[model samples]
Target: MSEVPLPSLEVDVPPEGLSIGETARATGLSVDTLRYYERAGLLLDPAPRDGGGRRRYGSADLAWIAGLVMLRETGMGIGDVRRMAELSRTAGTEASRLAVLEQHRERVLADLARTRAHLAALDAKISSYRHAVAEKENA
Candidate 1:
């Protein structure tokens, strides 16, 4: 099957910034998720508000959210993600952030190894079935 090209998530923000809906589209998150992020204190800085009190997201906000999406997709829990976000806002927390990522890396590596083992078992079973069928055909 041909692979379909996906739209780029990296968006260039204009001077005016993006509205909540625009940000949601750019980040591949729902509008409700954006509001939840605000209430959950996952953002480094509060979202800026326009004259009418609508949320406005700038380039930095989009970049940060992209990272959050990646982390979540990789199976990082919400609490850990929130911790990383909190660490980002403070000064001299680089080591803490590194520790969090390193821990997640280890977990991902373990999962990959387990999945590979399962794949190997499946391959061996398929090979045995194919051999049996070939012998039967010869008979």
Candidate 2:
């Protein structure tokens, strides 16, 4: 088999940095969510704002926001996210960060296991109903 090269996926960033709305569009988050995150201090310190008071998110800010989005998407609560963000700010908080993430990871793994088990049970029930219906039709 021949190998195929993937197409380029580079993004062009402006020198002045992207506005909050532009960052939201690129990150698939709503403008309100971006503002909420910033207001909650879930991300870094006050983002650079334009003279007119519009937020101008830089590349690093966008990257950090992306990580926060990932954590939220993975079922982490806002409190936990905030704690992790806090831990990340100070010096020598590695152990605390590890502890926080480990606890969340355990919970997520347990939930995943329960979901799989429930799915299997549902599948079995569905299969039984299908068989019963097929038998009735044949009769």
Give the best candidate by lDDT.
Answer: 1
Q: Write the per-residue lDDT of candidate 1 for residues 1-139, one digit (tens) a residue.
A: 2321223366779887999999998998999999998889887678999999999998778878888888888888889989998988877887898899899999889988999999999999999999999999999
Across 25-92, the per-residue lDDT of candidate 2 in tens digits comes to 87888999988987888985668988898888876677778778878887999999889889878768
Model 1 weakest 10-residue run by lDDT: 1-10
Task: Count clashing residue pairs per candidate.
Answer: 0, 0
In model 2, what lDDT does residue 94 have?
A: 74
